[model samples]
Target: MPAEKPSHFGASARRLVGRLAPYRMYIAISVALTIGGVVLSTLGPKILGRATDYVFAGLIGRNLPAGATVEEVVAGLRAQGKDTFADLVAGTPYLVPGQGIDFDALARVIMQVLALYLVAALLMWISVRLVNRISMWTVRDLRSDAEDQVHRLPLSYFDKQPRGEVLSRVTNDLDNVQQVLQQTFGQLLSAAVTVVAILAMMLWISPVLTIIAVLTIPVSVLVTVLIASRSQKLFKAQWAHTGTLNGQVEEAFTGHELVRVFGRREQVTARMREVNEELFDVTWRAQFISGVIMPAMFFIGNLGYVLVAVVGGLRVATGTLSLGSVQAFIQYSRQFTQPVTQVASMANQLQSGVASAERVFELLDEEPQVPDPVDTPPVSASRGRVEFEDVTFSYGPEPLIEDLSLVAEPGQTVAIVGPTGAGKTTLVNLIMRFYELDAGRITLDGRDITSMTRHDLRERIGMVLQDAWTFEGSIRDNIAYGRPGATDAEVHAAAQAAYVDRFVQHLPGGYDTVLDDEGSTVSVGEKQLITIARAFISQPSLLILDEATSSVDTRTELLVQEAMARLRTDRTSFVIAHRLSTIRDADLILVMEQGRIVEQGTHTGLLAAGGAYARLHAAQFRGAAVQVDAEKQAGEVPGAPG
Candidate 1:
């Protein structure tokens, strides 16, 4: 079954943080640099304030140097034995009251402030680079773990979910996580450091002003909590709707031919419109609620700013606070509020990221396939023999197969014929252990099938399905997929046996032609031939052919039948055929209805007995005879044959 969707944000967040365990050193360095940068940045306003104080002092006729007197100048010149000193002091400002400003000292202070800012910029750049590296690597590991988890999940999990929805969890959901980690993580960290550093600097400047500035922090937090709480459900709904929308698009496009044939364009578009509308609704609501946080925070921050300015002005007038200190405090107030606003803005992204993480963690936490026993022995070589004794199974509460017993000895071809929904494919699945049986046991060569590893059991069986899937690769590669290390000659031999060589030789790049994702470059019949060739290359002891030639033309069916005959020559084969002619030569034929064997015999024996199989065969041939007669009557002239 598909995994339950995760709803616990705290657990998911913890899991996301746990991904950083391997990169602790890198994260530590990043944090250190961030702190250093914030500390240096906080020093800028204070240092500039010092420069302001110096300019004020110089302008107000305080702490200026005294001008050199004529005697003092002559003594300095005699002591130094140089006239340059007199020239330097001739137009120099005096360090005395009512003198010019100390331009040299002011220049030095400005340069000091500039240098601190430059260092801070460099540290912030390095820190951001480190953060990028850490986030990207963490996401890489996350994607890898999710992919490995997918491989461990049972087929039933896939059976229950839409392919696109599952894919969204793996791709779009991970992309969301990556975006948050890459962009929001650094911002949040910087905001935190900035807020703390700015607070410290503010307190140092004026405790009262610091208290006034910090009054907005609680209000901002409270507003943020309320809005974010409301938006969390909206964000979750938004992603879920997005996944559903993606699923619809994927299904519609995948079955494009069917849609066109059935003229479902209007219906499909209308359905997608509904889902799109739903997605848009939740998306906008989430954005609007989260968006309110920043401006609200700004409003409260501005109120605090007004309070600080008014209170600081009063203190300054009372001579308790310096003008420079007030200037610094005002700058500190803006700086402090800025980080809070930034953090408030990131609240939405953080919420979205947590939602995505929850989805990903759900996939990771799904129950994996049952594991093999620790001391499971390797499969021993055996003559092909399969047995199902009182086997029972079900998809739900209703039993699909019950008390089903069958046997196929080595070199025997057992043909299974049935109508649709008669558990034909389910039987194949059960035999392959794709789904564990609810009751009874199956054995191969006297050894219980469950005792063998799935890998070992699957290695001994080859399947060719009706769909005939092929990947994007050369034809040679597709054929060799069944046995990866097969030689080129072996591949050619298999292709020749399967009649794939007939068409492949005519192509521009014989056996080397690359196919697209669906292998649509070739006809369906040709694709089926390629799949048969793939099965040929495997050379398994047991073979399962499930409606393998049901989709092909008569001529292609002939070729496929010939290939299948060769494939089943020395193996125990189970053939599920809709066309009775294809299995007329089987050693045993089982006719199934409602998931139970209604009759079991060879074709002639069943015909002579006039049972269910005989009735079905008669109906098919009777239809064929009537069609032939109709064609003959249409082709005949008035009196030509008489």
Candidate 2:
């Protein structure tokens, strides 16, 4: 069984950061841009405040006369050590005693404000772009790694988990992480920088006012911390519920027919509804708490701002604080509170991303089963001979095969036949090393099968199973799947031998006809033929046919059997057949029952002995002509052979 995922959200965050290690340049650029934007925004407010102070000092403190010329106003401020025209207006009074200040300097202030916005906008854009690009690249790598892991993982790993849940980890979890990357990273960085710069500027202008504004900091941090701590666990629960819900949906879709046949749709639906409701509840509570962070911070922020203004106003009226400094303090207060609010808003997104990252990393941390041996030598040459010596096997607690001994010499056809519950299929699985043997060893030619690299062992084997799987592709594509570099002529020939060429020729696009998912557009028999064509195209040194022709109609089965015969000529073969007649001409027939070889002999020998093989043969054919006759009879019927 696979390992369980960790519940900690911080683990996911650390994992996400690790993935970003490859893109240091992008991350650094993004941080730089974010800080630049925050700095510019913080400076804008201070510049406006300074300009207000200059205007007040020039008009009211200096008492400029009515209709004072711009030169006179500047001269008065210059005598007071505010020499620049820009500075004179910045400290001018709003209400002049005799004359109003000129609109020219106000226009300059507006231009400066406009310049600040333009620069800040560019910085914000760069920051957003960098964050988005970095995140997308990270997501791409993560998704690719997940997909590669799926292929490299042992097939047995899939047996214990639902397909939907596995998909949810890659799809839904990754998507959530991507959202976090794109949104939260930028916002959090910018907010932190903005808050720091604004607070510094506020304190620089007036430490007393800065302290007053910061009174809400502890309260806001306490609320955010509490909300964030609870939100992380809820977010983890949300992700888990999502996986469970997806699992249920997947199970329903895959077993639609079964549910209908068994009249259990209501049972399945009720169960799924329960899971779905739980998912909704989990997400709702999590989002609700996370959602409160922003508004709660905003409220505290407004309250803090009001307090700062009330206290600063009294100090200004008492002639202890300058109006310009008080005005600057208000802007700084907004800056400090705004980022804390932003941080609160971003907390859930970051936590959720961390949760997903943890899950993805856990999958990456899984150790692959059947690890390649260190310094293992490659096989010089692979002979088709295969042997099972005192082989014993079990899946979990039940023994599927025990004390099994068998061998197929090079260029020999060994048929395995038995009842439905017999271990014939398990024997083939043992040979393939899909499951390790609990006792004894299996050898290929002179080498233990286990000693050979799985890649090397599998490369020499061709398989055609009872249910042949095909991806959505053209007829030619399916045939060439096993041998990716095979030529068109080789593919056509393999298709012709498997009888798939006959069907392909009738399609509108011939060999180029596109297939639907699971190749459902094709007949079951035709799909089986395609699988055979794929196996034939590979030209493997050894072949295993597990009820290979069981799905094909009589005529197609004959063509397939003929193809199998030709393919088996120079290769060792293991034929696991449900129908006894199919293996009568095999060089050796081993009858398996309850994980043991009950009988072994020629067709006549088994028939004469009236052993397990004879009984199985009787059950399948009732002593009728064994080979093609049963197949011929099956064609006249509508369903698969018993």
Highest lDDT: give the candidate number.
1
| Candidate of highest TM-score | 1
Q: Each model's TM-score?
A: 0.90, 0.89
**Over the stretch 147-242, how does candidate 1's per-residue lDDT look in tens digits?**
999988878788887988888888999999999998887888898899889888898989988988988889989999999889988888888888
**lDDT of candidate 2 over 1-642, digit per residue (tens):** 476765776556776778888899988888888888888878888778757765665466345566775556656767877644425343334544354444577678768977998999999998899888988999999999999888777666777778887899899999988888888877777887887888889878888888888889999999999989988888888887888899899889988999999999999989998998998998999999899898899899999889999998776655466677788788889878887888788888877878777777777777666765667787766678888888877777888888878778899899887666677777878778787778999998878988888888888899999998888888889889989899999999999888888888888999898887678878888888889999999999999999889888877777678778998988999998877767777888887767788788888998899766665666567646663357456542222222
Shift of residue 426 alpha carbon in model 2, Å:
3.1
Q: How many residue pairs clash in all the candidates, one count each?
A: 6, 15
Question: What are the candidates' C-alpha RMSDs?
Answer: 8.5, 6.1
The local distance difference test score of each candidate is: 0.84, 0.80
Off by over 4 Å in 2: 1-3, 54-99, 623-642
